[model samples]
Target: MAAPTKTLSVADQLDQLQAARKLALTTPVYYEKIVKGVLPIIGPTAPIELRRWGAEFLAESLATPVLAKNEKESLTIAVLDTIKALLESGDDDPIVLKASIGAAASAYPIVVRWIIFNSYHPDPWEQMSAIKSRVFRIWDTAPPPVKLACIKFAQRIVLAQTVSNGQEARLYPGLDVSLGMITGSHPILDPRRMEAEATGLLDRMLGVLQDNSSDALLVDGTLNCLSILIRTRPSTSNRIINCILNFNPLKLANSPMTPKTKVLVKSMEKTTRMLLIHIIKRDPNFQPGAPGSQQLGRIQQYIQRLERSKTEIFDEAGRKRALADQSSAQYGDTKRQRTETPAAVAVTIPPLGPGPHRYSALYTITNNAGLQSFDATQVPHQLATRIVVKTLSSISQGVLDFAIAGIRDRLKTFQPAPTPSFAGAPPPGAINPATAPLGVEEGDDDYEPNFNAAEDTEQILNKLDNAPPEVPLDHTEALDLGPFTLPSPPLLDPDTAIRLAQAAASRLFGPLSSLKEEGSRKPRAGINRLAASSYDRESWLTVVTRLATRSTAGLESNFKKEETGRLALNDTLREMLFVYILEDWRRRIEVAVAWLCEEWYNDQLIKLSGSGAPLNYEKYALRLIDGFLNYITPQDKVLTRFLAEIPELSRELLGKCKTLCGDPTTVNLTLTSMLYLVMMRPPVRAIALDTVAEIWQEYVDARPLAAKYLTKWRPGFIESQTIGQSSAAASA
Candidate 1:
């Protein structure tokens, strides 16, 4: 007999729900199902834990990018009614209020987009507006978290409803409903009214900064949202920057300066500095001579003031230093801990041109006499004119003609005989006036000729004639440039060639086997796989695919080591693939699918006695599926592509799904995947239908959903099963 089933209590049910909710966050396939279950639990009458869990889940789901915009719109329509109830519940629980506000923020744009396309649909906008009203009413008296959320919601409203000019405008038609989108009159949506509401909300945000008594937390939140608005909405940038400049972080100061207060002050100052810098960096009008340059200057000056305030007012060390300096000044003591000299003032260098007529040195010279400074003005006009005239008249006509004749003779003449050295030699220490340098006079105090130029030139010619004929570099006799005979390398068979190559590779990469050496102070010898030049996604894909699909012909001898290496390679590749997909699965879904298909096909070939060892293809495939499901949202188009391209469904894979799926929602998703296969993938339709039939017969929770599809695809299958059951009952 089968064991009796056990019933779970309320606490157990809640525990199960908590786990399911957490799991559903990562597994997007079950989002709608999870939503349906949690909507009722979040009501005011449910336990706080359940309510809190539901609210947080709703907030994160709406905010997350995992779900596309259209999907979020659909979810918003479903959650609107629940959100309305939570807002009206009058619960002071900050968690509930904060979460509801956040969900509304994420949902508002989606709801507005819906209203834009379907102008006749008044229900969504009305519900959203009602949430808006409740939030504004509670905002004034709400706690810190709730109030902050309210500020963010206001920012979103402005971003959505306040249409801007130029590229700042959203490109998508229905991304956010704006006044400019509607051309004609509408029954429900008043573009002017929505825009005005957004403007008022913006004023409220700016008011936080305007008011001197505003809470530091509120100021911080206001500044944060303003930054986002400035980035995304160019029209609002000028106004937002002006308002930020007017506000001061020091104004939010309180007495006694608790640690919390100090932190808050520091945070506010940092945020303001960052925002101002961002504005300056991105400002279109900030270039030199632009009209906005003045504004930029003011912003820079304000930042400078804030820096000074940070040091003189808030810095403990700076404050202590200032106090010590004050005491020293009163006592007239000059010694100090550290003193900084005043910075040298910058002096502008005059541009290159004629200078003033007043005497100044053209250049200074040092000589045996003394330092002598030369002035251009001191030179008489006659002397300057004579120098200019000499420079102009120095070129003579005969010089060029003589130079050309000399060159023609040099090229036409045959090689000349070597010249002999001078027969007469000067006495030791005697200077030769005939070999004197051209510029020095014969009787000058520093006059000296180190060598006779005529003799030196003759000696160079003699050395050149006696030297060996110039040998080309390639024919140097000192180095044997032989076609040197190396004993003809013993013929290397293909096996030996491959062995030598493998040995070289092993020697080079041997350090990779052990990552680190024991008791060594030297830096690590192992390679850094995460270095910038290391393998990227495409490289890893190419190498791993080649390794996966190529034949292992001669490697069959050492089956044990080969298998071990194959498994390690598979593990590394699988890990790399998972990380690559996880980083950006939306765009890379096709990559993952292709890899899985290749793995499955390769596994089949291995089963047919292919040379390479079979891998844990199914293990990694299931792991990837698990991870992919976590990121999936309801009705994801990427999931459709995945299902369409996946390999043929197998019994073992389906049986594993059956083991893992314990809930109706997960079972429903599994059935949907199979149903998609039945409709879209014609080659696998029969197999997918058979799997669905098994699911329908086994999972009582999945039968109704399964029957809907099976009835159409496999006509009369359910009805025939019912008749068979009735006949068996009647015979028994």
Candidate 2:
């Protein structure tokens, strides 16, 4: 008979969730049993480890296809609700926030769908407003990692809010669609509430980008959020462009070139450059700041760095020192931290343009409902002119086509109005220079043509002088002019009509007039061109490599050998960079994996070995070894095959691989890699094999391998007693 099944406790249940594979592969009965057992114990007092495990577990289950879809989504909401309740009840651990963010992200597809269906409904699970508000309250005070995760969560919500695929418009059947819900309208709520939620989230992201005190990681994530908004929400693209343009982060690049700021300044610049590229690609007409001008010398230098030879780029430190050395010969090192300067405050400028996306959606619905197609000829010239002027002042440079038809309509039907000259108005024949019509001479700025000639200008002026003061002119209504149809009454005074027309034409063509003066160059003043240059793809990796890969040679020459942190990259930074790399790995896992390895070896390991201080970087080198081992699970064959290209890890290598021991499958891969190490190196074969045995003896899959290796290899575990607790504590 099989051994009696042991009663599973909450701790055991929590441990089962460490591998997302378990959630995916397990049967429904088993999965629900595990969830049922652990659900009641998820609280602040719950073992921190269990809560952390449950956090990531719930996240994975939400996305897992194995579970009944409704069950997983309902579980996801419950998990979020529990976490939110704990948070409101005075439990605000960074781990809780971090894990909850992961959970939310895992359930994002369903959460977004549900939100779209019932944005205005009162269901607690669908109340994004309350959930978002609570998150914002803690966000300013949250830990750096938590803040980073929260921003990422916000990014997903913003991304799901595109105008087309986002709203499930057909879902709202019973509701009446109003005109405001039609084309060119910005609906605050409907089948969805994209407007209010996106606006709040965007404001928070901008606040982080603007705040000098924000952690660099937070700033990097915020920049990512801004890029998503720009790409996905075209209606607010101009506003997003203006916010990024106003905040110049390149100046912050002048900060001391230690490892951390280098990554930050580079990432910030890369994202900003990418956002600008998107704008330019979307609208070639956009002209922001002075195009191709020398005003952006910093951006120029950054582009030059990419164009230069590898040696020049790698030798940047030496070149920077040489420049400083020359000045030191005459005057001691003059370099100061760039942070000493007062930073510009972030200004959140509301979008001036109307919601073109909303408008388009409305237009579509109306047309399909058998509404009138546009009659271009009948659109009033006066109204169209006003729209043209308003469009110029509101939209981004790329959106000139927004009101182009209106403008051409007004210009094509130009009928000059007689200027109403009160005693105080600008001289009738004499032009008002400030209100001058385009192409009209400055001296004749207020010119209004007469039926006769310039000689009749005096006669017209005398007629205006004889007009009764304060008597309203004959209503321009109910009168049938030969060609003109008064949709509404025309202006009683011709002066009002004439002045309005002149202003509209001048405002519409002011930038174009400047472009002509500059002789065919792109007009360089607006919101888009104000940004830095286009960024190359690898530029982001190059910067991350510079910071994430440590070089002992680059350390301060006068610094003592005992200075430890200077020799190896910080563990947290390595982990964060890994997160960033893994995020990208989803797109091109092979390339990202190869680049991560090549970068680590070339930039870090080579430098340490060449410096003759191999021991100084042992921790850093071993972490990479263990990091790769931890990442590749038994099921991940492609990453495993790519892993083979890396150099043989030393049997002497050992560091805390927190992710390695978390799941049985990953632990299995770690032992396999260790055994492979034994196969390759005969000298450490016994030692490496014995090391694997000690780490894997407890698992059924590992036991046979451990026993077989132990019979051949005579050695013992290398610091074996510490393995289990070490993995558990990292989660804690």
Candidate 3:
């Protein structure tokens, strides 16, 4: 025996111990042996071997399964008893505590199950609750990893019990004691556990309130926890707000404790104010009229009390800090207060562009229900015209009401009747019934008189003597408004005015070639007539002058040149002038036509310009001519081209006129006028056809009640062209 110990070196002894521990971990009997053997050795200053052995034994005990229900129960009790003893052992050693935490984590499920089964057993939850406080105490002194393990254990136990049974069943009667342990532990403050712990605590706290139906408990618990969390971590503020918003409102409303309800409400208000102030101070473009304004308002009201309670919350210093923080985050650097002062607020209203004005008007009309009831008649003529012109010029709401009013007025004034002058007369210098072709047989001479000339004359005289005196024919003629008078002469020469007018007119009325061949066969007589009336070079010049004057006045001060220059050479300035002139003329003409149609014409044109059936072509023609003369300016080349071509077409169709004047109501004529005017401008000419096509497509897509009208109008226009062309060819 003397040399037996010498046979094993220190390394060999350690190897033997390692082998035994592995065997204990793998085999049930060996595992129990290790637990019983190592428990007594787990104390302060224990040999390093004994410490290792104790840790290994605890790990094995947790993994080992006890047979039979009774044995499992006994094993769970033993594990809890062991944890309790270790907690009371007064060991502050980190390694020992870490080992204990790991062991306790592993045994949590078994302990929870046992406690649930023995809930009626004397102090079943109480015993575990006592251990819970110890867990927190150990966590406070332990390393971060060990602390994390403790939180993990708590989460697992809660999750396991909750999955098997609802929250009420899982949270034991003494659950508050364990919650206190968690609260004091401040697990939610741990960076690694913050999100999960916060979420769990929120759920638990809310569940407890719901089950107990006690607002006081819930409000107090939640507020206290939130206050602590907010102080430590402010980033979770948004997430908490979302949770509160999602909770059952009815439950909160029905809370038994009014005081508690008030407190909760106050807390919510405080949180809301904090969020809003942060957002407003940080966001430069934040406005009360933005999309989320309503939601933001509700939040603001919620926090109004808090704002009053803590007036300093929004003080200059706080605002400065918040701004500094925001800037720091944005630029990822420390920010300093700027030495320069902020710029002063601008007071003057800036001039608007056609695009912006039109867009603004459209947005207002489409999105704002309030504008629908505005009375067009109430608006001033100049303002209304400007609005309409600006809106039509681009697509903004800058002058929405004005534009709408202008359009309404124009629509009202549209006339359905043709001018008597155009309807009563043939083309200038054309043959009249009063001056029929010479040498034409006047009487029915081919049919022989019943008797010789003298006898026939005597018989005719006898018959005339016997016949009663002839009655005079009563004829009524429609009144004609005189040719449109231009307010002023245009700045441009007659030739230039004609060219510009033609260009403008073509933009409004597209080319005949673009129409279908069948449709092209008949040109609406009214359109031709209107074209002829508008073709008066002098009248068109007057229109151009009026338009140019209005446009020059309406332009934004910033863009206008201080000094005058040649209008033709300055392309940019010329383009601006051209746009302004067109816009001005269009608006004025629309207004004038609306007055004429609504007041003078008795709204007849609007009714006549239908989609189905033929329109009163002559009437539309007269309206167009009148509208152009009233609105067009002399410098407008586009309008001139459009008007110039109309007379030729009108002349060709006049030969086929069965009556002195053709019918004014015809879809063909209306479309022809619209198309011709659209094609007058080069830019408009390029897109006009496509625009009309798209409009038709959209009309069909919308399934509007007026779809039939559109369809019928398009075909009728074709018929008018066909009829016109046939008659023209025949006359030629």
Candidate 4:
């Protein structure tokens, strides 16, 4: 055998590593050669360039196709050990840290396999924790690239640990399994170890997202990681959701921060929208919060029940004390103190229980009740598409409106593109014209205005070079809202003509529809399915009916029973409702009319079917109409004025009534409900009563109820006799 070559210098090793990048992509290098030669160059004493290139070589070497798992095992360990040395050493060289992270990521498959074999090791998390801890410790000081690599590695591991029994995850080609795969049929190790470490890793990613200094790359990686984490371990889903909500970009504006570049802003919005889509699509129950793990869910419920029980007891005690005689009040106070002392102390005393129970996300979609701040500049068309498509399905009806607003705001980014002037057309310079859009004066038609192109160009150049014009100094410029000040949105870049054109096309082309998925508890990627403007009112109506009805159809028995859950938009979609209905108001009105009619028909059919399924059609129909009214009518105000503005809505209600009142017995029931509404909504009392009087004539059975209001117009009371009797009594 030939004598082994002399050990390569660090510089030589780096040179080879750099050259090998291209080779590694096409053909894997020998793992032993990479470990012994390239890896040594990454030692602390080596130059940053040498170390970075060296670490990168180790990352590529792990994929040596000629080497099977057994052959690669020793190399994998060697590579991971080097990376651990680099990372754990707290070497702050960003290039080195970043490269080592990439190196570690490349070895993720091996790491997972090793963990699989040692699933029952006394310290299963020991290795994972060490790796994760080192990453976290260095993250703040590391560059964006390093943070991004760390995030990707965490996601890979999380996806691997995703407790799949074949159905949950698809196997890769050739190989049957990865991500905790083990021998034969039982490849997966204990999932709890992976899960715990993954959660910690997720937490680390979230920290990067929360940091103000984080760049778009870091944000993008964090979001992608979160998407996988939610899929794999849904226990902390609510916490993840809250983090997204609180990571508000709008709020980031008007604060002292490194101003974001346009690309970065767009990227952040895009990433956030993508993240939202992942979340809303997973919780198939189409509700705001995911359920905690069973044990945690039960624990939360138990605690809530106890708190409610305590409140009730205190309420009862207070009521009794108020009604009690002096003697009894004193005795009751003593008894209350004796009982309540331990209750208050119990809250202070930590419970001797196992680790905290798991629950789904805590964030809720409160329909339009909670207003979310949306910056006019940040969430342009790309972002709006996500908000509209995902949030509108079931989480929030308001998403339709919110999306419209976001889109409109984004559309403002584009100014209509100017038509390119043909050559030799007087350079398309200013011409005196009667039709100048800005109202410039017209000159004589024959007047050929002399132009100094160079002077004009100089003037234009001067304007460009000039500092921005100053504005007059103004007052305090802030509105105090107790703890906060009213904010002004950040200045936006001038609209790009191209984006406007694209948005216009997207809006006109993309009429949305929901597509159900197989076996998924949540809605599928029912993203923008744009349509032509020719999609008439009826077609749009069908879309709304299908989406809305499906949301209700998928509800759980308990969700249907909960009053607050009814027709309420999910919190994520809080700002969208008003904008949605008003967009194509005529078409939307048509759809709403058709939808209500359909609901009425369904209610009648369900009742007639007598299936005894206890369909909550009554509540549904009432809330369907109520939901529409809630959007149109301002809160803490009567529905009268707003109801009048929506004449078609009233017409639809009356038309539906006319159709239903065709049944004689139903006329009285319908009129009575109408009367009840009139009484409750004082603002709309006249419209309600007037409607009842006008429609009651169709059915004589409704005449008795009409008597209550006849004196004004329906003549239920003898007006002339009543007037004369009142006059006679006054005269006497």
Candidate 5:
């Protein structure tokens, strides 16, 4: 071989020259030669082919893995130097600028890492800014993944500056732009992105600390991000605090420190101390004698210890000097030797008297006609019991009695008409009053004895005599006369009442059973009949429909029919009706109670005597004293209403409740229904605590049957207690 025969084409010669020129631009050791040779090639007529070949060679060099690490670093610095020269050259060639940017991107990671690690270099901050600006410009037009990487690099630069004592702060001039890249255009930054990128960055920094154990740089960077996060997004601060708190601070304490790490630790300690102080100050439950006082005391003690520790960390010489100063200060402290006086004795008031149930009387009377007419015909016994209970529970005894009296009085007004008078013959040409007179004649002398006047006089005499009055002979004869006596109105019969009761029970319970037996052998026809018949009467059908229409769809089909029947009686129909009635009653009661409270609060008795001015002080004092009284009085009124209506409705409905299955054991069922209704009403449910306590005391004192029902449902009482305890714990 004649050593490749030296047969070079013009293109081959030009390529060799371009490769040498590119190598000179990348190597810092060849800076003088490149500046001399490449600086003069920038004129308009400069060889286009040679310049293009040089730029291509430079771009290719970035991908070479065989380059030594030191050589690669040298190449990065040289490329940056050339970029600065090109930018200052005032060359506005789009192609050249684009080529330079592409080349710089290929070597960006290597350049950034080198510059960051060697941040102590004199012009490192300036170099970082230059690099960052270049990266951002390229990133604006780059693919998403590349843009994301650029953001990551910017974060690294911020971290690097934070570690270097704020030396590179100016490097992150477009921080908001960088954040936009990471979070995209989402209104609320996606937590998933935050977790992946931001969280991972912190974890990586933490990993660096873990691996190196003495990497103050990494620790400082992590703390900077944490501090920024705490300031900008306070809700996320708790999460970061939890993360740090879970870590053993003692491990970090044992690690070697640069002065920077020690400063960071001090800053964190101060932040924690301030946070704890604020938590303690704002919490009213932290005070003594308050509900959770003991837990508050423990937390206070822990915070005090932490505060003391922080003082010790900052006050090395002051801690020792403070004890000596305290001893000297106490030497002449005569005021400290004086004993404190005890507080004046408090006047004790006697407890209040028993509530209104003691003074009130409760009774029930059956509407015999209503009972007989509807007992077994139209009403099912179970359903009738429900309706009776619902109606009775909803109204007060006073209201019920008033309603009954009104209805009876109205009935009496519809009495039979008096018999026609044909006893005397009319005078010739004298028209009969009933036949001829369309209107009553004024001043008529032939006036007959008024039968209504005689009847009123007879009733008055009968009332005064207090004896059974004799029936008149003509009245007895009129009773036998056709068309004189009216026919008896239809009374509520037992069978009809029973049918109504059963119908109600089926309507309430049947749907629940059908839902449970959807795909089973039992036909859903009976349930459908029950639902259809009682749909108008039961309110829970609406609730059931709403609940069934939720995303979870329908109720389970595996429920036992008997169980569902019982539940319908106890939970759905009775409960819903009770809640409805109670709510209506509660609203009315609250209005009355609030008015009474306002009146009592503003009463003359509550004001100071003989003062023209309003006695605001005395008025407030009386409110405190009479507040319980005001609450209880209206409460009693409401209870009285409830007791009157509930029991009567229950008794009436129960009497009517004889089902096809025969009279179901209904006393317990009725009681359960009453309890369900009372408990389900929001107002009643809200006051469950006060109500239970009041009722329990009454039960002890009066031993009423209603009290016995409350005792049977004691689990509800315990649940309220548990809730109170949990609330107390949380406040503590």
Candidate 6:
């Protein structure tokens, strides 16, 4: 007789239900089962696991695009009662609430469309309305995931109820159930009421953004909703943007930041930035003072404020920059060491020599255990074939002995007993254990050894260890067939590799490099190398210059005589500095001025230390100044500002400035340089006045240009110069 059927336990039933759910969701033909079979299994009376699974299944089935609109509509009608029961059941299970609310979100619009079309079946609409009401009642008190799901659900309601234009209707069909979609509203279905409900829900979502103490999940959820609504609904864009404008993403706490608050701040700022970027990109044709220009401007300004707040909240201690400074200091020290001893640490490109004429090993066999455990299939096909061929080639008599011994041991350990030679028994050729030979077993008999089995296995292992090495396959040599020879593999050693890379780079960058040089011959590299004018390079130069100039005053005081003369801007670096400035002096003039000022200041510091000779500071300073005078044109006004900003105006530098007197432009340039020193640079004012007085007495070309600004700037100097001229005339 057939065995009686066994009943499944609760867990077994849940497992079967899960299996069915997966099959239904994965298979397109079984998708209808989610609404029909799956919907009946989830009720108030069902198990929680079954209900959770059913809720999640309905959620996926409804949200998925695989199901057609009519299929989804029917599914929505079938699952509305279950969704309402799941939401109102007050299970407090996050999975149930999240899945049920998510399902409701996907089903909400379909049910609204159904009610709009039929106007007779109001049951689904009422069920969905009840589900939404239950969700709202628990939204504030629910867990974060459930609350987030409800926020999305509310967004769907707003999108479905809000009236879409004709263009939007064609884009996303059947989503809108507005009065605009149909003529004459029925008593049961009021698009106006539905729209008002959506409006209230939108206000509620915005309220989360407005609250200073809202949860992080809620705030992010609300911003996400705003992003969707603003993109999908054009009518709500302005109000949403305005709401985002006033929302402070970092207003979570007024106290010092903890780890939790830090996470919240980061999440909120990231979401806010993404949303602002999205909104700005939608209408990026921004013209200042235009009709919609103010809105985008406000958004940009808000993003700036958000960034500043992030910096303040997260990096207020400057830890990131400090780490960068430490790293740069370490790298700078290493670079300095290398540059100091260039000959000792040479990097000569090694010559290309013929490599060993043998194929490379596919994998190194570290030990016998690793070799035994290694899987050849895991390797690539080409390598696996090479390994198999190599292994077969290396097989020897000792290896054959080891393989035979291994097979004998495995057979003896698992050998079955011999049965009598009958119809369904062992065959006539099967050995009887009593008459079997050594190391073989039969008929429940133990293995018989002619000698010690342990000693024999050890001898076989030793033989395996001493097996002959495989013959090497040399790919470098040509393979000769009966009438043909195959070519050798290509050589890719270090020297050839370097040469290949260099050739490729030269081909790609040859024209660009030439263009860089040609452009460098002029004032700038233009597009050839715009990095010369980049702000990062400018900031780097400024920072290092200030660090050396402002921070080295005390270092010179306690230094040994030899170390006291060590300037941050050494000879080679100074040469590079001069070239950098002369290449693009107009744009990088401030960098040059800062370096010169630092040099001048450090020169004073070294002088106070009573060094053997004047430091090279004056040498480098004069070189930079002369270089500028030589390279800068007569009408270039940038050099005037550069010279004025120099802290110390030495006599040698002033003498160079007094000699430019060939034309009106040259005279004006010289006079402007001297005038800026007298007016803007306070510390150099006296020396500049002295140079101006000397220029006024000595050079007639610069006198006319100097008199205009000097009269207003240094009236006393001009008068005293006139008196000195009179006294000199009287004495002469």
Clash numbers, per candidate: 3, 12, 89, 28, 55, 1
Model 2 residue 51 distance off true place after TM-score fit, in angstroms? 0.9
Model 5: how far is 727 from its true place, Å? Answer: 99
Put down candidate 4 lDDT per residue, 367-477, tens digits, no spaces: 333332333346689988888787557665555565456545534444467766687555446663644644343554344544654556778888888969789755555
Give me the runs in candidate 4 sitting further than 4 Å from their true place: 1-13, 19-23, 29-37, 63-74, 89-91, 118-130, 160-168, 173-194, 208-217, 236-238, 255-264, 278-732
Native-to-model Cα distance after best TM-score fit, residue 381 in candidate 6, in Å: 39
Tell me how candidate 4 scores on lDDT: 0.53
Among these predictions, the greatest TM-score belongs to: 1
- Model 1 alpha-carbon drift over 4 Å, by segment: 1-10, 166-177, 252-254, 283-294, 315-732
lDDT of 4 at 545: 45
Q: Tell me how many residue pairs clash in candidate 1.
A: 3
Cα deviation at 402, candidate 1, in Å, is 88
Candidate 5 regions with alpha-carbon error over 4 angstroms: 1-13, 18-51, 87-95, 116-120, 134-732
Write model 5 residue lDDT over 1-732, tens digit each, in one string.
557677666487576666766665554445335533543443234445544444444555654655556666666665665544443334434455444454555555455455444645635336535755665566445544344444445444333222222212345432211222322344433435444544454454345334433333333334444554433333344444445443322234445655666675665555544544554465343356744355555556656676676556556646534333567675755554677798955432222233432211112223355653443547888998998999999978876676567555544444567866685856668876657654445466565644464457878887879977786678677678465677897887655654565466446545543443123434323112342343332323433332222212233334454443343222233333333333444433332222223333333433433323222222332332232222332123343333322212222222222110121222233333345545654344323333433434433332243356555655466457558879999999
RMSD of 5: 37.9
Order the candidates by TM-score, highest first.
1, 6, 2, 4, 3, 5
| Model 2 / residue 161 / CA error / Å | 5.5
lDDT of 1 by residue, 1-732 (tens): 999999766677679887887777767767777887778877877777767877888898888777666677788899998988888885668999899899999898788778878887789888998999999999999999999999999998998877654344445444544456654586677778877887788989898887743377888788878865766565676788788889888764656677777787788889889878876887555555655677778899999999998777676654334445565577665555467889965433222234343222222212323334445567899999998789658956665455455445543343367755575756656766777546566664565555654567888999999999975685456677668686887898655665564454334333333433234443322211222233344333444444434434235534575345433433444565566677778877766766676677667767776655656567766676667666555445665566666675556655555542346446666777777777777887887788888888887878888799899999999999999989999999
Better of 3 and 6 by lDDT: 6
Per-residue lDDT for 468 in model 2? 88
Q: Estimate the overall C-alpha local distance difference test score of candidate 3.
A: 0.45
lDDT of 6 by residue, 294-388 (tens): 68778899899888878877776765343345767755654346544446432222222343322212122133566756666579999888888
| Cα RMSD to the true fold for all candidates | 19.9, 40.4, 39.6, 41.8, 37.9, 36.8
Could you estimate the TM-score for every candidate?
0.48, 0.35, 0.23, 0.33, 0.18, 0.42
